[model samples]
Target: MAVVCSKGDWFVSSCSSTLVSVNLKQTCEPFVFDCAKAEKRPKETEGNNKSSEGGSKEKDSDRILGFAVSSSGKHIALTDDHKRLVLFCTEPTWQCISTRWVVRRGTSLVFTQAEDEVFVADKSGDVYSFSVLEPQKPGELKLGHVSMLLAVALSPDDKYIITADRDEKIRVSFRQAPYNIQAFCLGHREFVSTLLVPTGHPDWLLSGSGDGTMKIWHYETGRRLQSVDVRQHGILQNSDADTEKRFAVSRIISSPDGRHIAVQCEQFPSVQIFLVNSGIESCLNHAETLALPQAPWDMTFDSQNQLWLLLESEDINVLLYRHSEQHWKLCDTETPELKRVTEALQAQANVYKGSVGLESQFKHLYKVTFDNMASYLQKKQERLEQQSKKRAANSSKHNVGGKKCKKESSPVAQSTS
Candidate 1:
């Protein structure tokens, strides 16, 4: 559910409901917020041992399936199974102030950068946008996809909206012109799990499907930029019949720099990093799997370019993967023995093809205990500074408004006196 940057200053929300904040600048407390307690309990606990794809939403009523954070880090949009769209202010605290039920069962929520509009999609494949600034007004647009909406994403420029669905279709539509459907990118043979539009590239869309392949498409040209068969790489293709999952590609993300694309391999417990070349080719081989302490179902990179993996199963371990001295290392809260097992496996050939010297970093096996309390405290201090800046901005605006109001009221008060 949460990924923090390397310096431990910034964080991002994952599949979890609450925001995880860290202050790396201080060493007293690095992480804050209890997302688990904030979530609504699952409907049923029967067969609690059941396993699902890494990113699958738990049966808990409070679990959030799809969410999008604004580029400016000022707002967050989230959706639940009840077709509710909840908007929260990111500064000061994670407060859910705006809530609206768009459909009987909503699937995804996205927002435009320049406008106050927030988009919500449901299982029916229909998309609706309500103004976050004014939720009571009628939604600006209503459009339909060819199939059930699996995921929804707003383009980098917030000009277009793209949706991937069960019918293996990706539909692109304008944000302002809701009645018009721009184009459909059709190629996937199975259900689509995720869709991503890189930060600076609005014309391109990256999609992952149950078909076990990640495809890059040029939305403007309706062309297939490239397609990499994720299943054919590493341990993915070797899945036994007894271990097969119902869906695939739980999550996909384009790195901040837009040079690489990392995709979660369904229930395979691994992540594949591909090189985003001119034609969307994979730079790493089958060994590019970034192995987690457990099967990683949800993941994201922080501002420091560190990998934060969230496990779906009973193993509540949140592992942090950092790059130092030219090799990837793991930072975890597991036992020394368990950490050793992870290091041994990660250092194996089947994990990453091009490298091998990264295991020495694990020899220290740092634990998240009081001894390392300084690391966490440092992170907390940084968050305090960010919060302070937000408060300052609000205070300045309030003071300016107060002065203007006083000036305007002077004439009225003089006449009354």
Candidate 2:
């Protein structure tokens, strides 16, 4: 698992069961604590034994399901497959601040807007909030869903809590009173995998789903403003009957200024960029489509809007892209720490599964195909618009001529009478 801090530092968990912090210069050092040696709650151990008695097995302790860094860059949190939640401090050397066990394995984690609290969503569809300042205290249940919760986010002002579940429902509820649901954004045909509200646009919500589409929603009114068919952009092929089940939108993130949105799939070498504007009709204009050398495992943007991509290849490298001359250009500088980590991971590649492989036999499609299809669709839309305008203009001219004839005939009839 990998997370990028606000200050452009990267906190990545390696196969060695250690979390390493990489600074801007690519220097990497072991984090203060080893996650393997962290103490497990007694209750969690009891639960594990009960599960074993019931013929169920416990998950690997080293598997990290979710990881996140607070927006302020002061706090970092991660949840492992053993149902353990760990928090750490980034400054004055990395230190494990707190470690607790949740009711179930967590799937996602997010910090509240104020940075005072952190929310953890488990596989059982329950959300719990804990005070960041007080690590010893227990967490309180905030909300829940009947289906498993996949993603969660907070409103900019902390007024509402937005959550997406496996049932293709995005629920908006009062932050203070989660039972009082404000609205539901429901249009995806399959499970919703990701949810995001742009940095500046508090009223709008962006969602991606297994249905191979990304939708823009007016969260307050539960109205779907726009739907972008991501499958058309080479994420999936139309000939595949199981398109809905095969491809899913893995991630969607907006730029810090909320001017650009980047989208990615589970196993793909390309990232789709969309330009956000005021008008809903054109909010998802395809600004640029970039193809990378390797399939990207994760991506994030820094304060300066530089796009950072972590590839899943054996050569560990973070590709940086900067907007220049109306296009995203790759920077020439490469980090030495990326190389170090890649080499380390490569040496131990046989000992452990290093977070980079596809389970299914999905053929790799080219980005040029998607670009060509987009261009064709744009031209087809333009042609249809032109034809409609011509027909409207001809109808107006015919109406004018008919009125002129009627006036002439009326004068003739009056003279004859």
Task: Identify the runs in model 1 with alpha carbons over 4 angstroms from their true place.
Answer: 1-63, 135-141, 236-247, 279-287, 324-327, 332-417
| Top-scoring candidate (lDDT) | 2
Lowest lDDT block of 10, candidate 2? 360-369
TM-scores vs. true structure, each candidate: 0.64, 0.76
Error of 1 at 305 (Å): 1.7
Residue-level lDDT of model 2, residues 1-417, one tens digit each, is 343333446434333355555554455544534567887669656566457447446655756677777876778888877667888887776788888777677878888878888899877789999889899777799999997788998888889999988878899999899999999998998788888888778888999887678999989999988899876775554253345444677789888877789998766678989888887355678788887776677777776777777777655556777888888888765445445544544454442345556452113211122588888999999999999999999999999999988987897778988
The Cα RMSD of model 1 versus the native structure comes to 28.0
Instruction: State the displacement of the C-alpha of residue 303, model 2, in Å, after optimal TM-score superposition.
Output: 1.8
lDDT of 1 by residue, 64-158 (tens): 55667666566766665443466766456456666654433567677787648777777667887877778546454478875568788887777
Give residue 74's error in model 1 in angstroms: 1.2
